[model samples]
Target: MTFTDVLRYTAFSSDPEGGNPAGVVLDATALDAAAMLRIAADLGYSETAFLTPRPDGGDGPGGRGFGVRYFSPKAEVPFCGHATVAAAIAVAERTGPGDLVFVTSVGEVPVTVARTADGRLRATLTSVPPKVEDIDPADLAEALAALDWAAADLDPALPPRIAFAGARHLVLGAGTRARLADLAYDFGRLEALMLRLDLTTLQLVHRVGATDFDVRDPFPVGGVVEDPATGAAAAAFGAYARELGLVDADADSVLTLRQGVDMGRPGVLTVELRAGDPRIRVSGEGTAIPTT
Candidate 1:
């Protein structure tokens, strides 16, 4: 595929400058993994999405289906929420909004795209069943050391845990917004620890309200220092909150996560949890970045 084959878009915000930018290749059937990686690294985005029509796939009234893969600069990731959102919108702009199914490395993801009242396209992705587990003390300590955060800086109420929806993230709650805002960390040290633990990002969060949070993601494993807007971490955090009884599990709930403010690319991520379904729903607005 040539450079023209890639589409640049930002997820979680309609304005191209405010959200996480990603490279979306609507058709990558001719490209191999190495080529995809090279393209992703060259683009210098947090992640790039590559899609190919599946042999068993066929277009229907609902929408189209494609096998999707996510590649960071250094390696392939299991899943990427922001890139998925950006790619879905990129597809909808050409194919029209409707239901979309993405066969990802983790599992099949169902996405619904619809036009907003303001005419922007919005996409919602239902995550796979989520699971939360306690992190080992030693591992947690190593991570904190890498981040230059003391254990006392963490909120005791929220606790620390490893959560997974499509990707693995170590969720750490900061006791104060100031702690979360100051995000200078040892990149190489953190990357080594994250690689050992198989973590995609460190979901750093500071609670604003019962259902609101200020969040940041350190994505060293993905070859990025930070993610402006992270959908996978938002999904995992939703599960972590529900599993910890921080939210009402028997009833539907919505959460708002504000991220990238410190980086000056503020974006918002909406997470919805239905009572009957254990899966989390992540919704965001996306738009194509204008080419100069």
Candidate 2:
């Protein structure tokens, strides 16, 4: 019988008290779908990652490479950025920092891990090519109603759209940071709309600068009230901002996203965009959640 080694790591922040927490099963080859889901549900974090290494001597942490699947407490998701970072750092801690590949349901993701001079481990995940689309007016109204937000509360410059990197996110920009911080919504109504539209989270954002944003995600579909430091949505937002000509497309840009302040778990996510590359890169530091 094989035992799966499970650990908890927080992504996008060096402090364990900050960032988003993820359950990491470095070895999950023996587990079936039911077993994995059960583990994830019992953990009750936003998401948990399961790894199944390739047969060619890839069964160890930071081995050659591995196949990764992400599961929320409720259901499996296509991709999860924070968990990806958490897993990468976990592997790098054991095998040293370098490049790693994750064969995900969406596609192959290339991640580079490195240790900083300050003794922090950070990982960057390049997302699949992102796409931006228009959302129906009815759907938009429904989302606003559920959140008790008026259409006038939206930032006219940013607009509203559906963005996709590895997973689908509904992007709505708030005119003010205060609006972004206040988040009390109808969970069931939002969940129903998210299910119908296949949305992973609602990316509520307020631009602080040309490249900095204060953001929040409502993830009722994931069986979580909110997500702190949502790197997946940050990647998708990079594409959305680029599409709207909010950022320079010809120059490499670094975007900073601040999240989870109101919930008291402040975290930061760094999003990078290359001049010609269509894929967005989301980077953040990860720290181990100490066993208590």
Per-residue lDDT of 1-292 in model 2, one digit per residue for the tens? Answer: 1338778999999999999999999889889988988899999989999987854455435435878999999999999999999999988988898888887899878889998899899999999889999999999999999999999999999899999999999999999988887899999999999999999999999999988999999999889999987888999999998898988989899899999887888999999999999999999999999997
The best candidate by lDDT is 1
Q: TM-scores of all models?
A: 0.97, 0.96
Q: Which stretches of candidate 1 lie over 4 Å from their true place?
A: 1-4, 60-63
Q: Evaluate model 1: give its TM-score.
A: 0.97
Q: Top TM-score: which candidate number? A: 1
What is the model-wide C-alpha lDDT for candidate 1? 0.93
To one decimal, what is the Cα RMSD in angstroms of model 1 from the true structure? 1.5
**lDDT to native, each model:** 0.93, 0.91
Q: In model 2, which residue pairs have backbone atoms overlapping below 3 Å?
A: none
Each prediction's number of clashing residue pairs: 0, 0
